[model samples]
Target: MTTRQNSSADQESAAVVILGAGPAGLTLGNLLHAHGIDCVVLERSDRAALGARARAGFLAANTVRTLERHGLADGLRRHGRPHGVCEFRTDGGRFRLDYGSLGRRELHTVYPQQDLVADLLTHYLDAGGRISFGTEALAVHDADGVRPVVAARDAHGRPARWQARYVAGCDGRHGAARRSLPPTALRHQCDHGVSWLGLLAEAPPSLDAVGYATHRSGFAGHMARTPEVTRYYLQCERGTPADAWTDEQVWDRLDLRMRAADHGPLRRGRILRRTVVDLSSDVVEPLRHGSLLLAGDAASLISPSAAKGANLAVLEAELLAEALVGDLAHGDATALERYSRRCLAHIWRAQEFSRWMIRLLHAAPGTDGESFFHESLRRSRLDSLRTSRAHQDWFAENYVGV
Candidate 1:
């Protein structure tokens, strides 16, 4: 937990400077360390805060393979659980899908994101990687030049400068990386007009499989996090506060929406966390500007409907690391030249699937004819998924592909 503080004007140097210590930055740092490349990671939060943040838990099969290939799967392999089933409940009835048995027969690995981040941090440190836990990157300057400068401040409010051959912007959507992008950058964005109240409870999962319930009231989702913890999402109005409802009211609404009378009772416990997440997606074209390269949410912001944000982050990190290594080690810039195109292809694909999942789970909040029409379409899509193998295969493939 050593913090770097420098009030002097002298600049530190590394081959690469990574912003953010989440999955993407840590993955890139670990890979670079293994390749004997010099790199430093800068994170705004302290070590404890970084390791305690909770996020998506579902890891697609391909994501698991990527981690395994990089020798980064030890934590997941030791504690992750394989999950392949998802149950859907609607007014018509309830149906379940064993997604692992369909399409390519792939499954997701359930590993809490906080634990995964802790593991990545440990691995990176063990490899002698340098990470400034409480340092904040203020701006990236002169990225168009061969040498870029990262202006930052340490936890003690002391100014610091980092000069690097290259900069990797893995911070996040609102981080300095995105803020420093030039006006010429192309940013495509969409708002799905849906919001959800995400909750973490200290209760066991109501269902063994992932549960998605579509009710006239709204949508309710249930997913297991750990043996004693469960994740839940309740469709909510766009401006509703996270604490809009009491615990008893929350459970009552969940029961009504999930039709617990016909199904079963949900295990109840203390609600540990609550947050409002609006469904939106955005992507930055090229994903690179001169010496600065972007990865993770800084490159693209995908909704959590499909659990693709973190998976995409790790995938992009690997691609960028390989390209960086090749360029620095052997002066081969082929991979580097095509890194944006390669990662953008996968990012767009995942965005499409995530948008589709958002539509599948949420009904547009309205009583107009257009709203009714969309609801019918949603029902039709669910029916096809329930009755048609072709539809199921398509859903299964996209559901776990990214």
Candidate 2:
């Protein structure tokens, strides 16, 4: 590798240059490498920082099967636990749904996302994968041409370039891949007018199943991340600061909304982290721009209402790898063009389900005429989900299938 500064006029070439080292980029790297394709992954973060990013941990069944098929499930299978039940708490009462046995007869694999990233990183490195950990992609140029080029800055602030036959833009929503798109690309966005005070508690899970509590004050949720760590969410005003509430206040509100007094007291612990997430979703139409393609959050950003972001990323990566492999290895360009369409279909379906979940979980903001109408509908929907087997089956299918 040359360390000289040539104003990026000099460049290195690969058959495919992937930006980002998350699930989408890493999975694509492994598949392409296995087929003897020349590729490299450029990630902005160093290895240690990248591995410490705590993220969504629920993996859909299809995501699990995809990893298993590619010899990538060794760590997940060895350590992940099967989860299939959900407990709902509402003013009407409480109910539990054994979703695993309902629709597709599948369950999610409960594996912390940080651990999964670490595992994928290890697998790729041990297989002689080429990766630049501290490389930051600044922009992509000439994506519509035969060879796309990525402008980048290294850890030492040195300018460099990577020219490739194709570029996989899996970095993220704010990464260079999205920034480099042409003006003709379309971006659609929506804000659900709600926010969540997301919390990470260093305490054992109070219950054995995923819990959704709908209370008059607000919505609260409980999910188990590990034996010692739990994830919780509380509905808050859109502009509330993450630190506005003290630990005692957070716990008291959680207990109130969750009706812990009626059922059982919650296990309290130190709050390790706090994040305020405004509920929003967005999609970029036509995920491909000539030889530069998009995946993961780069293609679409979904609210974590249904926990579909990571699963969708894995699915998109598999589709993209197959398409690229067919074109580069077998001399067929048909699948390359079809890749965007294939991924968009799944993206829309997942988006629909995610929107449904958002509506189901949160109520109308204020007590107005329209608010009552919307809240009534929400309650009716919940009732149907609780009593109607058909509705339950549908929920189970979408919840775990994605």
Candidate 3:
């Protein structure tokens, strides 16, 4: 609903045009707005529809610090659940990784993605930022500079094109932003056979903090939103369909794999929603194609095993805003050119950690490996992590991104 004037020009223009209104786009837009930069966000979904999307509940210490730097941490800290330790359960027993012991921060928090989105949306809108809903990008032209044009349609179905000094494609994996980039220059991907059946159940979280349970049957984890709501994940066949599962069937499977003796009882409630997705990793080089730059999932993705999705996206948005604003203020492109490189440094490290974590927990199906093999691998890794101060230091640095 916000408008800007374009004098002596038939087309609308701004300092930047961002596609998609997800976390990355909204965060970037807010940062730009704070710096007095003009930009418009075009989203395919209206505000109500955005709440229907999936959630990544974990937020890292660095991410919280970044929000604090932006003066936006009060609301998040107030609503999110903070925990100092993460419980890792296996057939042998459960071990805890205290974030306070491992890193400088006391604990990470779990804030529902919907709540975070609502917060960012509120902050952005309150400041006169525009989010054009029910708009889809048809094409992007001239990525190499002189600005880029986004061809889109409004909610009422009007075709339109807007040009900007730069365009940020925060449109996600399938959006035109990623598709518009030339593949030959920036194709990097890693695929894992694992997939997860994600469920948002109405039941209360079984634990005080995040619990990652690894059992002989499969891998499952518990994440919390509030005292009464929990998010659960269970490993499944890559293409398992939710329709194939009745509520009772789903709960039965979850109850068997996720519940631990330490955790009292598995309480079931109304099944809010469910979906399945393959675990994969990808990063497009440079994150820039002409005037169009990618951020968030569009630029890269990490496995949920790493618990990096929301944190990384928020980090990327903050870095992008700083880079763009710094460049504009000083007439230097250093920040812009270095953005992808800087992000990838952290991105790849998380990818490595996620793969390691998954391997430690999930056994390949039909593997005829001996019990000794599993025990040896688990003990060796854990022992190394515990004894090697340098290695633990590395993990601590990566965990908090210091």
Query: Quick one: ranking by lDDT, best first?
Result: 2, 1, 3
Cα lDDT tens digits for candidate 3, 1-402: 122446234367677888988888988999988888888888989999897675887778888888888866767888887766667666656666665576454467777777787788888999999778898987788877676788888788888788887888898888888878875557689888788888889998877756777777788878887788888888888778965788887777777776544555677887798878688888888787777888888888778876777787888898888888877656778888888888888777777887877776676556556756865777677667656776666565565552
lDDT of 2 by residue, 1-402 (tens): 111222245587788899999988999999888887888999999999988787788899999999999999999999988999999999999999999999988999989888888888898889988899899999999999977889999888899899888999999889999999999999988898889999999999999899999988888999888889999999998899999999999999999999999999899999998999998989998999998999999999999889999999999999999999998888888888999999999999999999999899888778899999999999999999999999999999999977
Sequence-dependent TM-score of model 1: 0.97
Mark the regions of model 2 whose C-alpha exceeds 4 Å error after superposition: 1-10
The pairs that clash in candidate 1 are none
TM, every model: 0.97, 0.97, 0.91
> Lowest summed lDDT over 10 consecutive residues: which window, candidate 3?
1-10
For candidate 3, what's the RMSD? 2.9
lDDT string, candidate 1, 3-117, tens digits = 2334245688788999999889998999887888888999999989987799889998998998899899999999999999999999889999999999989999999999988
Which scores better on lDDT, 1 or 3? 1
Rank all candidate structures by their TM-score, best first, as comma-separated numbers: 1, 2, 3
Please give the distance, in angstroms, between residue 302's alpha carbon in candidate 2 and its true position after superposition.
0.4
Kindly report which residue pairs in candidate 2 clash with one another.
Answer: none
